[model samples]
Target: MRNLRITLIFSIIILTISCKNKEVKSENKNSNIGQFRFIISDTLAYGKNLARISEYNRKLKENESSVIAVIIENELEDGSTKIDTFSDGLKTPFFGISKYQTGKHKIEIKVEEKMMRTKKLPNDSLSLEIKDIYYTYKFHVFIKDKVYISELNEILSKQMDIEYNENPI
Candidate 1:
């Protein structure tokens, strides 16, 4: 009986995985993906720590689908690099353009979220706030070139319902 139960459970799990993959493959054939590209034009290398704060302002409409969140990383000296992410409802996205940066850094900047939480407020709350967790970003970054942080483009974004508290000070 024990062996039979184990085999049955294993078979069910395998079947579930195959079913989900099939659905995703069919969905992708009709998906319309949006793309945003920026070119950083700084190529001078120096020895020092660098840090900069930036903002992300993109308005996601009701039920507007978003692709993967992009990560911009500046590899540091101790095998550690500064990283920032851009995605839907990313409240605060701060980066060091290269903080305490020991050397010159890369050409892109993305914001970091200090405090991001999704929870239902009290029943007596007066506001209809929707804190939706769309999905964890599929991580990808291009090691293009080294540049200063000032060249980042600033744009206007919409307000979100997610409660963001911390400031990256």
Candidate 2:
């Protein structure tokens, strides 16, 4: 009867410890639920004018599944614009241009998983532009005009590298 009592006491102590540990883990998991954000930039120049490229904001959130959003803004007048959204299985690209004859413009992009509410990985963006120039002669002098065309490539090469290092996706 003494051995039976000792065995019951040991089992009760073990069960109590397991219940406490589970509570601690549940609290830790709740503390990490939120969205993350980052920023990126690039530049191009021609003659006396300069074109600047910067993202509005980069954000990732955990919902029914993982969702990533990228916001891109351009600060140039007369230049064009473009946006691209990318993931492991799909790619989407969009294009636009400045509204006025000269000034600043913006474009926004959002990406999310089809279904699920869990953790999410990191994402990337690539901005590119080609400037074209035309010249005409008047009064034995040359006059030059320029235009900008923009494109966004949804290439996740850098993200792949990070994943290769055993980092979060």
In terms of TM-score, the best-performing candidate is 1
Best by lDDT: 1
Model 1, span 101-154: residue lDDT tens: 333432433222221112235883222222222211122222233353232322
Residues 91-129, candidate 2: write the lDDT tens digits.
121222123333221223232312222222457322222
Root-mean-square deviation (CA) per prediction: 15.3, 23.1
Q: Which stretches in model 1 have alpha-carbon errors above 4 Å?
A: 1-41, 48-55, 59-71, 78-94, 98-123, 126-169
- For each candidate, the alpha-carbon lDDT, in order, equals 0.30, 0.25
Which sections of candidate 2 miss by over 4 Å? 1-34, 42-83, 89-103, 113-169
TM-scores for every predicted model: 0.25, 0.24
